[model samples]
Target chain A: MITRLSWVSLLVIMASFRFTVDPSFYPSARSATQAPKEGLAYVAGLYVGTGVNKPDFIATVDVDPGSPTYSKIISRLELPNTGDELHHFGWNACSSVLCPNGKPSLERRYLIVPGLRSSRIYVVDTKPDPRRPTLAKTIEADRVVGRAGYTRLHTVYCGPDAIYVSALGDAKGEGPGGIVVLDHYSLDVLGRWEVDRGDQYFAYDFWWNLPNEVMVTSEWGVPNTIEGGLKPEHLRDGYGNKLHFWDMRRRKHLSCITLGDDYRMALELRPFHDPTKLMGYANMVVSIRDLSSSIWLWFQEDGKWAAEKVLEIPAQPLESGLPEILKPFKAVPPLVTDIDLSLDDRFLYVSLWGIGEVRQYDVSDPFRPRLTGKVELGGIYHRMRHPSGAELTGGPQMLEVSRDGGRLYVTNSLYSSWDNQFYPEGIRGWMVKLDVGSGGGLSVDERFLVDFEDARAHQVRLQGGDASSDSYCFP
Target chain B: MIYEALSALIGVFAGVDPSRGWLYAAYYRTFRGDKWFSASLVVVVLSTTTTTLLTVAPALIALRTHFYTGFLLLAYGVNTLIHGALKAAYPRAHYSGPLKPKLTHLAIWSTINSTLSGYGLPLGALTLIQAGSQPYFYLAYVPVVTALATASLFRGVAHARSLTLNYDLILSALYVAVGAYSILYSLSTILR
Candidate 1:
């Protein structure tokens, strides 16, 4: 029989072993100083200003390795309003000819940024000077609500005929939110695109496999209900349960199926680039009630859409077991918040917010996803160590893939209020770059990290983008 | 009318969320409140019970001396003991027909019939207190209680006839359902 002293000795030896182990292994790759295929990537940076709803502005970060001030902020475009939460934005025109409804010009001329809370959309002219982007026009919230009867503008995407904007609530902020349509070139309010307002209320994200004539997933619940802090009751009551399907050309509702009673709050619908492959992936953000955060694969069979949970991102247990200080909040997984597909439709990248890690998966076979690589960063439980010897606070939340599928940039902030609840250490404003190998392996780029220690930065967009805007209708 | 009023009163006291209330209402409208479905379901249950007894009785008698038979009986005894313990821990308010005193005492003791009736009686009581007598509550409770009472009576008759087949089958089915219900109930409570 082992005594207490023997157990203590065993514990001590294990702890020492863990401390001495090398955290990450570096594989052979090209030099970090090699030039990217897209030339100089002028990244459109959306950051929260100095104070509460005060300093929210869009800046440009020169991400090109060959540039003199590479990985440094080049220009700042300040917004007039303080409270406009500048979140997700998309380009007006893409360089690909396969882009839906085909624009007259393929220049990445305009960048459409949506104010998540304020309901305003800013149209920025990036063509004037890609580095120094200037705000051309602002689509006021009141004007959109007046015409379209929807509020809380969430995601902006360039569809075939017009730009589609997913909003969270109605004019009075009550949900069953719908999508709003706008003229691609003129920025004209074309009105709401909801078919019949059957059950879909909370709209978060939507993507289409244009050739398959289908759009797979859409989010549920309102911003106010979901963003009002992380309460267990609020999570169960406020999150959504259904994944809707729509006809691509007709812009009409076809079918929808509930994912699961427990798997709620479906976000980030990442559809594969191969239009013939009628399959896409979505991740669900659940609270402690369901700590096993999962990624679901939705596919079409004989023309109807159905989804099944493919993989669960497991929560990492505390090394020394649960400490006295963390006993109250209960154990939770690294919330899988965002998902992005590579341009070539080979690799899938997922962001874990609660635990700081970006997981990469090879999803060539949509049903069976094989884990390729994972890079741990700052999170609620584990604070990531920066190269400068500083411990970053929050984990990765939003992910953006490079056009060539060689690089990935991630920022760590979900929402203003929810960010504070999870990462109580306060938002450490920073974004990191990961080098993606051709075989779906990942390595953190030691030389290319954008540090914004003062203000909270989020959602990175490339100068002449590739993936988000382009849609291949014919494989 | 009085029972309906009392059920409504208990539901109000239970204070379930509005979402659950909607679920309860929908379940009531579809299953319990629909006379044709309820009647058909009762017939199906009775026919299935008769078919199971006729088929399984002779086989059990033939295998009476088998080693598997002794193992099954041992497993059943352990299941009964655990079920009794659960019933004792979570005591419920039981009804003894109409115009009878409500039994508030926890079931610390166990009988062969009570154990064979499965853990459904105690589980139903707990669900009644937590979700009240809402149709959603009855959706699981009514069928379970009915199955238990019918199975217990049939088990007794089967034992008297010296053919333990029906008794064995009913007890096994009860064991599976009870185990599943216990796990799901615990999960729901903890998660909530």
Candidate 2:
């Protein structure tokens, strides 16, 4: 007769081989909102503007209020190479692991960090000890280019079966940027994701509604235009102003919506967290006509996709303290670099990088956004000091909301070259947390401020799952 | 005989890719224990074999010639190139929608593939006869073909039960390898 312990061991071994999905993988956005609060947040720390020659790193900060190391940098997993210019990174496996037909037995333990400028990818294993993540693998630039025929890697999203990465340009760093896929387990570059690219060329950000089988990809300029920093001529003639929709299941570009030539650089897409909802928000970074930024709602209409401008923030006219890039305009353009939707889809956070303000809008009714709260810190003219009397340099750029939508973490750096052009004084990278009110309000957490002395900070991801980190298959 | 065998192998791969292979495996898994479906599958296979032997074999034998052999090889190469190009251009041609729609597509595609590649076996036998080749030389392929087909079908069934194995990737690799091999061999035979 087999002992009870032996039987238990056998069952455990069998379970390991059963390919169980991660417990953190939520089935619906609503279910994710009820997940336990994340204790640590990962922020991309870059040493681009600083005189330091050290490589960019992913900083792990303790966010648990009860911990003695709360709001402290617990650890920093530095990349092996310098000039990586780490922009946005994500978990290797997300809620999508639970998706129907999605690969199983995969754990959400690796962070897929991509160097926007270097075009290199790092697989950081956040296992055994989440705080002390080690570099597991580094996929070189040539391999990525050879596999996907793309460069200037951007956003990373964990799909059902593969880790999807978006690139800003082709092999020569030219037009017609697209997505590259990697195997979930090995982290090996699979190939380009598009089957029929259609007329879409420029690519920056992408998000999808899985059950609806719809994926929306936004656009920014190619490497030639963006790497050298923004130019007025390029903004007029070169930057992308269209949003492409795709059949996610078929991997075919179905249609596109031109936000018009006036609205240039249509970047950053925040789809509804609910899988059943077919609508999402797309932010146009800058309008050449008025120097203002606008957000639009894209939804299915009459069996086709359509987008309508929902909210517009006018440029604040500044008489003095203008950067050279904006001196001719004589006004601060509300460059909405990034936006994040709460897990419950009740709130939308928009980051105005130019004028240095992060606004919280009640998007319960996405058609009409009501401005509920706003926080001003850093800008071209007014470099508003934090409540702690610490001087802040760059305005809010990347935003990450907690799983419960109770806290919002904001990072200041946009892009390395863009940072130097906009804030000529150089961006002293910093990250701050805002305590979101129970109803609709925002307040700076006076006790929580992460000061990266010289390194510039970009995207922030919560310990477990953030509002934008994961997508759902069920309503 | 070798060219015909290679052509048949290419046909086997072209009939299904990663996506199509997975779909067929899923279909089998869905109706595995159903007596009616199993019976229908066996009947379909038998009917297809009977029809090809009775009609396609004699016609190919009557039309056999050295010049015709070269033409056939070139024709197969060109056909493969066009089919591959079309697949590359419109990858979404494969069914990904509902199962009901996919079943119809699978039936149509299966019929077309069989009709086009059906000449491979007969052509190979006729080519051997024309060359006055020994019977045992061509008969050697019987066990090899049977084992390959059986092993691949079994693997597909196992993969369908557990999604962990990426049988699709294996299928895709097999398709590319067989397609490239068939194309290169056809070109060399025609050129020589």
Winning candidate number (lDDT): 2
Error of 2 at A67 (Å): 1.3
Top-scoring candidate (DockQ): 2
Best by TM-score: 2
lDDT of 2 by residue, A1-475 (tens): 2234433543443343322346677767787888898899888999865668999999999999889999889999989999988999999988875554354345689999999989999999888899988999999999999999999999999987688999999878797999999987678999999999999989999988876667899999899888888889888878898999998867899999998669999888999987657899999999999999999999988998889999999999997888898989989999998999999999999999999899999998889999999999787756888999998998988999999999999989998888888898888888899999999899999988898888999999888879988987655
Counting clashing residue pairs in each candidate, in order, gives 7, 0
Per-model DockQ: 0.00, 0.02
- For each candidate in the order shown, give its overall lDDT on alpha carbons: 0.58, 0.73
Each model's TM-score, in the order given?
Answer: 0.63, 0.72
Q: What is the lDDT for A454 in model 1?
A: 60
Over the stretch A313-410, how does candidate 1's per-residue lDDT look in tens digits? Answer: 77666543233333464564768988898867778899988778899999878888899989888876666766556666678888888767888988
- Candidate 1 pairs with clashing backbones: A49-A55, A53-A82, A100-A160, A101-A160, A176-A201, A177-A201, A202-A221
